[model samples]
Target: MSGALARLLGRAALHAGWIVVVLAAAILGGVCIGETAIPPATVLQTLANRLFGAGYPLDRIDAGIVWNYRLTRAIVAACCGAGLAVAGVILQALLRNALADPYLLGISAGASTGAVLVTVAGVGAGAISLSSGAFAGALAAFLLVALLARASGGGTGARGTGQIVLAGIAGSQLFNALTAFIITRSASAEQARGIMFWLLGNLSGARWDSVLSAVPVALAVTLVCLWHARALDAFTFGADSATALGVPVRRVQALLILCASLATAVMVSIVGSIGFVGLVVPHAARFIVGVRHVRLVPAAALMGAIFLIAADVISRIAVQGQVLPIGVVTALVGAPVFALILLRARPAR
Candidate 1:
């Protein structure tokens, strides 16, 4: 037993170390490869100076841009990616649907509606922050969906799964229509453009405050999911099977779904509704790590962080002078990849 434990610890450490190296490299690239083009060495030196007081005589402007703008944006991007991906994994597992994602519960659409209410409709009279409004909207949407599911005869079986998905669709459409109506009636052209950009995911405004909000939510959600990893694995075979295996089906579902919703709400509130990370990353992680929840969870998070950072970088450099909406870039890539996954999933005729 002692020898087995030692080997397991060693293997775990190796995996952790590898993940750190890869994530660090991705963050560094995100910091260095921008419109201003700071070198990798300068990026490292700036980090050393700010984080450790190494003080390697760097230009003030460059350091400010690296430390303030790019680094913060990269970290927030990572948090968004990880949170969304883990949420996706949880939903796909609990719902037992390959197509399930963070937004499947109408959270993103609700968040967009809430943000529009704050920014375009002036619902708060300038008192509430956009993020706060978005979060509120997400919670409202989820509550409505949950109630709708219950009315539709919620169960822990296939029937329950279908009901939840349908309810989510209805909730999403309602909130989306509300958003459109508000924008059409209340927003001027300029305000509409800005709101639209944010709705499609703009990380340009990411800063230290965004980082502080995002990091904690991401960590908390990930830890909660990991804590319930065994329960999640039991869920893969359906709620009845999980219950038979001594798992509290309804309780686990409620807890993990709430965790997914909270994580999704916080991320959407911070960076707007960036899609496909929650959808595509889990599928990719499943391909790489198989179906085990323990390995699949962290793999999805790591791949998600790298994938979104890369997408963000592409969004910045895709056009000569203009940054494309990160959502557009994600859709452009994710749609085709998902299509291929669907084709592969089809059995031989």
Candidate 2:
């Protein structure tokens, strides 16, 4: 017993340290490693000068690049990664599937559909924002899947994974098709090209406003998930077992799902559907911290932030002069890892 406790404490300490390391790495990658590569001392001096009015030597263009573009992209990437990973953690628990993610579950697709409508069709021009439209669409998609699963007698009983997966597949396809149709009909050739880039997860537009809008919601929802860690653990043993333990299974499930979906929609609205952070990060965190949500959630959040920030850096530098879509980078990295995971999951014959 004492040995197990010691191991757990050690893992907890590692998780805490990992958070600091990743956060520092994010800053370094954002400020010192991008195009025109600023020096660490210069980056620190620039920040110090801004905060403390200290005279630090730096060129205006370099300072502008770091402060206005790279740093903002880094911050937004971190928020996006953390938010999506938390959503992944919740959906995996909610649906009882290791592979469940916002994009896989169609939530991101729904958000994309809504954003495309706002941008292309001008659905709510002058009145509604893209973020609001995406949030509504995300909720709609989740509700549609839940209702379909429930109708098919899936969410509450028997190998519910099949039902949720099937429902999600159907809903995702429908929304994605709708998004494509909207783009085709409403967008001009140039507008269609821009929309396609956005849908593929462009972070070139990352700014302070996007970070301000996303981080608070991401932080709040992630904390709420961590607080409910025990309840989520109850879910691992199935709904019947959870009920026997006095957990209001349906209510808690609904609340967490809504929170996760909302965060996902907001992030997707801003960044345009970066996939696999949610799916991949939690699993990686689980390998390090086990399945306890308290440690798992924060670890996954930090790991995700690191993953996306690193990916953003790579996206910018991969092709000499042009930046690639973040979604493309993550998909390239995640697909093989995910496949290997599945191959390992194949039961011994």
Give the 10-residue window scoring lowest on summed lDDT in candidate 2: 153-162
lDDT of 2: 0.86
Q: Give the Cα-based TM-score of candidate 1 against the true structure.
A: 0.93
How much lDDT does each candidate structure score?
0.88, 0.86
Q: Please identify model 1 stretches exceeding 4 Å from their true place.
A: 119-132, 149-159
Q: Work out the TM-score per prediction.
A: 0.93, 0.92
Which residue pairs show collisions in model 1?
none
lDDT of 1 by residue, 1-349 (tens): 9999999999989988998899999999999997879999999999899889997999999999999999999999998999999999998998887877867678788888888888788898999987788778877888898799999898766778888889988998899899989998999998888877888989998999999999998889888888898999998998778889999888888888777877887788778888888889999898889999989988998998998999999999989899998989989999999898888779998
**Residue 237 displacement (Å), model 2:** 1.3
Off by over 4 Å in 2: 1-18, 155-158
